[model samples]
Target: MLCENCGKNEAAIHLTQIQNNEMTTRHLCEVCAEGMGLSSGSSASAPLADFIAQMGKGMLAETVSQPGTCPACGLSLADFKKTGRLGCPRCWSVFDASLRGLLRKLHGGTQHSGKVYLPPHPSESDRTARIVSLRRSLTRAVESEDFERAAGLRDQIRRLEAGQEA
Candidate 1:
């Protein structure tokens, strides 16, 4: 498409503005748009951005002013923010508003109500630690020549490692 401004260059951007009950559309190439001072249109409203940032900060501060207690687990929102995790399901309900705001900011104004996937069994870190501890016990049994204890420890370690792969 030819640029509305130049007519010679291909249109690479579309700028839309509404004023006085009339909508105006500007089709322009990047160079023409930049020359017309329309490339950084939003940055022209820096004061508005600053005002919004201040308002958001104030809202977050107000939300955190009073200690929030989860109705289900009695966990505090302030504590959860500090720890980066909620104590229980009730904490989610108690801090629903604040969490919604946070989620919107993080995910582009959309609430996250999606499915969560969990590991089938213990995580690799847990499996590795358990296996290490079991191996130590197995070594002790071997040193004492207790075949039965060694066999049991070996079986436990196998189960833990197998769970990790699942």
Candidate 2:
């Protein structure tokens, strides 16, 4: 088929999207696919369908079943597809040839270039700790009938809640 987007080259890439029980498909050549960020080295992250398209476009049909099953859990490609899961951790290594190649194509290269995840920031926790300490002091002031200190602590907590540095 001729490329749908550019109508210039032969289509080598095909994409399909299903939304709200409706299906839409696009056929594109290498140039158009890359322009749509559906190709390797694209800065924009492709969605799950793009990942599947990268896998199933032509490779799935041409791939010969690698000989033998996973040594650790005995999972074949067919079993993995049918079950939609790997048999065990070792399945990754056992299926390394196929999996790694697919990953390389879907991502730009073998190394992960995307952002590494980080936990909540330390300053946020520190703010929470400060708030807790102030609340405790406020409670102690109230217990001792120290209205002036209690009011000051209450105002500090209100400022903290308002996102002001107290």
Candidate 3:
């Protein structure tokens, strides 16, 4: 599908935003999405901020200000929309509802799916350190969407478990 914003590049990012019982949808290309700071490298808060902004464009604009603002930092949904950055960590709690939906959309599931690695080393400390290293590798694999490497990591973890049982 063509990008809603540019109408030139193919839309790769499909966003459905809901706020105050209102829903708004936008399909954007990588470039357009990046322009709005909605690209992959952007911070976790960007999509939620953008989604809130899109939803606010309709009837909820005025009503959202008071309740939507972070009590600690005084960062409103409007401020998030403008900056694409949350005022502080407290903003996460303040806007938890909105961010949850955005997160579900971005990731297939809200729960962490990345595998944890354990090693079969004799020394407990060595095993712990190896597990930490392997977990870091697994995290990078999942983040990069490298299914092959992730599968390998899973298999390695399984082998470690089998060795432990023996």
Name the 10 consecutive residues with the lowest summed lDDT in model 1. 49-58
Error of 2 at 78 (Å): 2.8
**Could you tell me the C-alpha RMSD of candidate 2 in Å?**
14.3
- The residue pairs in collision within model 3 are none
- The alpha-carbon lDDT assigned to residue 76 of candidate 2 equals 76
- TM-score of candidate 1 against the unseen true structure: 0.29
Would you give me the overall lDDT of model 3?
A: 0.71
Query: TM-score for each prediction?
Result: 0.29, 0.49, 0.33
TM-score pick, better of 1 and 3: 3
Clashing residue pairs in candidate 1, if any? none
Candidate 2 achieves a global lDDT of: 0.77
lDDT of 1 at 60: 57
What is the C-alpha local distance difference test score of each model? 0.71, 0.77, 0.71
Model 1, 18-62: lDDT tens digits are 999999998898779889877644434455445444434534564
- Candidate 1 vs candidate 2: which has greater lDDT? 2
User: Candidate 1: misplaced stretches above 4 Å?
Assistant: 1-59, 62-67, 112-166
